[model samples]
Target: MRKMPLRELAERAGASPSFVSQLERGRTSASIGMLRRIAGALGLTVADLFTEENEVGHRVLPRAHRPELPTGPGARKYLVSQRPLRNVEVYVGEFDPGASTGDEPYAHGDSQEIFVVLGGRVTLWLGDQDEARSYELAAGDSIEYRTSVPHRVANAAEEPAEVMWIIAPPTPD
Candidate 1:
């Protein structure tokens, strides 16, 4: 859909192009980590890969049908937006104590993003080490930032935390 070459996608996802080719051909299965990396590289949430093209007529999405997005250890996310993706995409995220997106921050495409803390507290780390800024957000707090900025989100409290992620203009593809 993005007209991205397999090699390029593989390079971004940190996998061999041949492996990506095999996976695309249904000759191989991708681990959760690989799937997450591929989705990120393509400027998409992992669950976007499961959206069926023929679901245009549906008006309601049942909980049983929601796609679970693959995330890092101790963290889980679910796709909350309908597909054939429009101007925005949403995800509901749950993080256990000390859970985080990763140890390192990452950046995506040019889209903008909003992160809302629905429960507990979370720390939002923005930029690289030298210029990093950290915001401790409690329930009901939210932060908006560019998706292209290297950032990471982590659970700041010992208890579980819930968050909502919203991104605009859905990446290119």
Candidate 2:
């Protein structure tokens, strides 16, 4: 497979070089409009960029090969699934004390999501601000919900927390 240089992609997409770099590194999220522009520049649709192509053989993706997605200053997630993404995507999240997705809740595409607390304690907030519900999860606890509504996750404990996230039919934006 061929890869486009970050600078070249940024130029083609009419985005800042730094923004493109951040996107490539999975350190940031892009708006639908920006995603469309980037995909168009690459001669692909937003879905085309995410859906995996059919291959004849099976492959193994070692731990080192997993992509890291830094959500914020003190929180990070690792994409544990193979690329390009398949029907479902898995992520392992690590959050330091006081770390969170953000102060405000955010929503993704209409995919179904499951969050499992692997270790430590964390809190999950879901739905719109007016009717938001909060859940405190400990190790081994899990919750399932749709990604259409806004949500936020945070580690309010003094210790670090680990969680697993599973999403089906990965969304483009």
Candidate 3:
């Protein structure tokens, strides 16, 4: 993987080094707006950041080959691609009942996110300005919203909740 220093990347993106550091280390989560700014500063599209580099042909990510990142104790995320690295990102996330991706609110630059409920229910918290929104999703329920403000998702059902999330420019941190 080609990685850049946090300080240099932050300076290039016109963001704080600490913020960039947090993002790189996955210590902080970013909103859609922040993601756009960082992507633009880095001369990339939202999808580019999420895709893997390929020299000749397209790569197919099998279920077993997908990168399952640990979001929390009871949460897991499978990233969908490895190319473009900027404009868009697709992920399948699963959260056990009472599990959370993060305790703090997540904010980033300009972008949008689409969440398709595959199973169970989840409570979506849209920053400190709005009240939590709860939705029970089966196989078809979906929601789309801007990612400029801080937000989070938690499983509210007794069983595990599965969601497919598509974010522009990918999420920071």
Candidate 4:
């Protein structure tokens, strides 16, 4: 597969270089308008960007079959469903105490995220918002919010915090 620098792609798409970088890194979310522009520039449909091409008679993703991707200095584990019919992506994340995804603020297109805290405390910062909301979440505490707003997640406890996240349309290129 051919890959392009985010800056070049963003320039071609008339988007900010930083914004494009964030999207590529999955550090920020994008708006619907932004996604359209990017998809157009990349010669891909939004669905094509988010969905994996189907193979005939493919088996499901077993619990142990999910690939783990790096999430900054912390661990963000994920499992894309075996069935390709779903429109959302599910991730299981674990953060060490005081670890954050990044310090930058990012925005994305028409996406929603629901985070269920499995243990410890989590601090969330929303786009340009001055105040950071801290939640002392246990096994069942959940918070759902729009992904369009720039946001960041951090572990604010002495122990590792576990979270389950679901994002719509997935993170874009």
lDDT of 1 by residue, 1-173 (tens): 65678998998899999999999999999999999999887766788877776345656878778789778999998888876565688889999999998888988776889999999999999999578899999999999999888888999688999999899866643
Query: What is the C-alpha local distance difference test score of each model?
Result: 0.85, 0.83, 0.73, 0.70
Which sections of candidate 2 miss by over 4 Å?
1-53
| lDDT, candidate 3, 6-44, per-residue tens | 785787677899998888788998888888877766645
RMSD of each: 7.1, 10.2, 9.8, 10.3
Estimate, for each residue in 1-173, the C-alpha lDDT of model 4 and write its tens digit. 22556776798689999888878799999888888888866645666557655543656777677868667786576665433324666777778888877777556654688878877778766656566554456767888888787777887678898878787655443
lDDT of 2 by residue, 1-173 (tens): 22556786788788999998899799999999999898866545698667656562687878777779758889988988765554677889899999998888989767899999999999999998678899999999999998898999999999999999898866545
Worst 10 residues of 4 by lDDT: 78-87
Better candidate by TM-score, 1 or 2 = 2
Ten consecutive residues with minimal summed lDDT in candidate 3? 127-136
User: Least lDDT summed over 10 consecutive residues: which range in candidate 1?
Assistant: 50-59
- Residue 6 of candidate 4: its Cα lDDT? 72
- How far does residue 113 in candidate 2 sit from its true spot (Å)? 0.5
Off by over 4 Å in 3: 1-11, 14-56, 129-136, 171-173
Top candidate by TM-score: 2
